[model samples]
Target chain A: MNLTDQQRTLIEQIGVWHENNGIQPAAARVMGLMIVSDKRELTFDEITEALSISKSATSNALNLLLRTEHLEYITFPGDRKRYFKMKISNWREAFTRKIDDLTGFNVLLRQVLEVRNRNCDESDEGLQDFISFLDYLHQELPNLLAKWEEQNKKS
Target chain B: MNLTDQQRTLIEQIGVWHENNGIQPAAARVMGLMIVSDKRELTFDEITEALSISKSATSNALNLLLRTEHLEYITFPGDRKRYFKMKISNWREAFTRKIDDLTGFNVLLRQVLEVRNRNCDESDEGLQDFISFLDYLHQELPNLLAKWEEQNKKS
Candidate 1:
């Protein structure tokens, strides 16, 4: 599908945003194309042509996106081609995973704190406070996710 | 001050973690050194010696960490040297900034949804759901932070 000039600009902007977030340029461009595509779902050839990226770059980007749950594919009856769309669910999943990481990190911090506390005469107040903050986040994240799920149910 | 072999290993591990998260190795090493330092504060020369990093690399890393609020400095009344330590407050600040970024991204996504909705015949349920998720996060993040602050005050 041919992209209009305006669409091209929007894609470029999205690409910049993703690139700033540490995504490689080619993969980010593919993501940009997928997000702004009017067709919603695009085949491999469609993505490659629309983004003007090499076949290998497109393949690698698609593979990365798929592995990371940033993209998913759809197959229609009797159709050999797989159509891909952005995995919007992955947005929430990404946040959820981040919360989990924070939890894990907090746990590790606590272990470190335990060892430090055992060895030291003076308490590390800063580390203690940071742990408190992490604990608060760990406790609140689940409640927040629950509220979101409740709202989703209502909607 | 000299680092023990164990301390060196710990610092390297932290550096690796930060590098995986897209932080430069030098900055990550600085962060790791700050975290594990028994004194909790280190001068420029101390950091350079402990990490075995070059003067220029240490200088650049410290500057980046200072600018990012990841590190802060203190001075004794008679001492000319500024001693640096990790900023625990910045941990919460980082999470707060992330919430803000999510809020901003959500607003941009909503605008995209509006334009896409206007142009397309079918509603993009995935985009709508993602927006809903963002809205839920936007509403909840402040309350979570407030609760943490309240708990902090009580403690």
Candidate 2:
């Protein structure tokens, strides 16, 4: 499908930002394309040809999305080509899992500090300061999440 | 700073996941390092030297973190070197802003859809469906944010 000049520029902007942020732009591109396309599900060839990226790049990118539970694969009863679609199925599940992952990582950090702190003398100001930082995160994250929810409700 | 074999492996695992997800591993590494390190703030050269990456990479990555408001830089009165530290100042701000950016982009997509949908009529079910998908995102994000907050509190 031919993209207008404006659409082309917008796509490039999104791609660059995604790349910089450490996300594969292809998935976002695919999402954009699927959302804008006349057809909801396009073949592998169509995706590669449209994005001008390699098939492997598209495949790897899509695979990551699927693994992260962001996208799902589809097959029409008679159609041979598999189709892909975004899963907004549970936005709560999608976003919360990521946040939970971050929190879990924080908990691991606290454990490390606990073990290490015990081995060190109380005079180790450096270690104490670092542990304090983790403690701050532990306390702050819950409130932050609450604020996001409140803002969400207001909006 | 020499890392144990186990530490190195763990770092690499986290790095790969961040890279795959489109986030720079350096930021993740830095966060990981902070969690494990005895020291709180690491100098620019120290992070670069520890990660075995170029100084520019460290600088750019740290600057990006600073811009995102996830990190802060401080200069001690006696020390000439600038030190970087993680800031848990506004976890909600960091995430809410990103969601806001996504919402803003949808506003543009909606404009494009208005034009595209009107022109396609019955022939373009895919395009219409795509627009609906975005419309769903627009509607559901705030609700998701609320749920995210509740989950955070329970944790």
Candidate 3:
């Protein structure tokens, strides 16, 4: 069996995973295609062909991935075409940023709560619970990660 | 100003927030309305009037909330109408369940990784990074929460 056939399920799985995380379907498919491809670097035409997606869709998906810094392109010294590959080194930063970004969301939740209280005889109880939970996460998630790092260093 | 006018922005904000989290817009608006209402318990007609949504939309949203256990109904001894209210008691469980749910996602990611390797000369680097990150979280997040509980008790 060919590489594509072998990885069809993987590609579909990753595509669904990305879609669940709120990525556009086409872009998610592109992400999955990149992940499972044996040929690490693929040009525009190659990506389009491998995914059975149109040029317009491939272009759009590529741009989205580029903007998100998940993928980057390289050019051969004499070649005009760009070959795209995953930006693997920044995985740690990207994952940590997801946690840090919650701080901003928590601030918004606080604001939401204040506004909710204005029209409420009894403020929303679930909102209060959610805010406190996020606050605890803000205070303690970093400490947890740091402790993990410390333990790993010692071990 | 009436309660609904006062909460217009809060409702919109929450509606958008839930939409971003992948909830349907109508259901999200209903969730928001429940959070900001001056009246803790609302009948079907009241929910419909406040949101200006169609009867069907209101009914569907209410049912969705009910199924998720985010909202529940209460009835007086002689009154027939059910009054829908937010389920305030299970906030901690709802929030912590989110973290526990990641275990299921991580398991799927492992399976996805295995399948991807079948077609690949080199495995996906980012997938490897993400698995490690989740593995770290799985190992240490509970410990971190436990430590926080202990510290609170001592203080």
Winning candidate number (DockQ): 1
Q: Which ten residues in a row have the lowest lDDT in candidate 2 chain B?
A: B115-124
lDDT per residue for candidate 2 within A1-155, as digits (tens), equals 67666666566655554455456678777656555555545677787888888999889878887887767778979878878765645444644565565655555545545433233454244334434443554455456555545754564
Model 2: DockQ vs. true structure: 0.14
Go through the candidates in order and give each one's DockQ: 0.43, 0.14, 0.39
> What TM-score, over all chains together, does every model reach?
0.89, 0.58, 0.84
Runs of candidate 3 with Cα error greater than 4 angstroms are A1-4, A117-127, A150-155, B4-6, B116-126, B146-155
Collision pairs in model 1: none
lDDT of 2 by residue, B1-155 (tens): 66555555555655555555456778767655544454556788888887888888888888877876667878989899988776744544655566666566556556555533334465444334444544555455556556645654565
Residue B115 Cα positional deviation in candidate 1, in Å, after optimal superposition: 3.4
Against the true structure, whose lDDT is highest? 1
Compose the digit string of candidate 1's lDDT tens values, residues B1-155: 75656666666776776776668999998887887666777899999988888999999999999998999999999999999988876777887788787777676676566444235545477777778877878778878888877888886
lDDT of each: 0.78, 0.61, 0.74
Task: Give me candidate 2's interface root-mean-square deviation.
Answer: 7.2
lDDT of 1 by residue, A46-105 (tens): 999988888899999999889888899999999999999888667767877887777766
Which tens-of-lDDT digit does each residue in B8-113 have in candidate 3? Answer: 8777777887788778888898877877766678899888888888999999999998988878999999999899987876555565666666666677677666
lDDT of prediction 1: 0.78
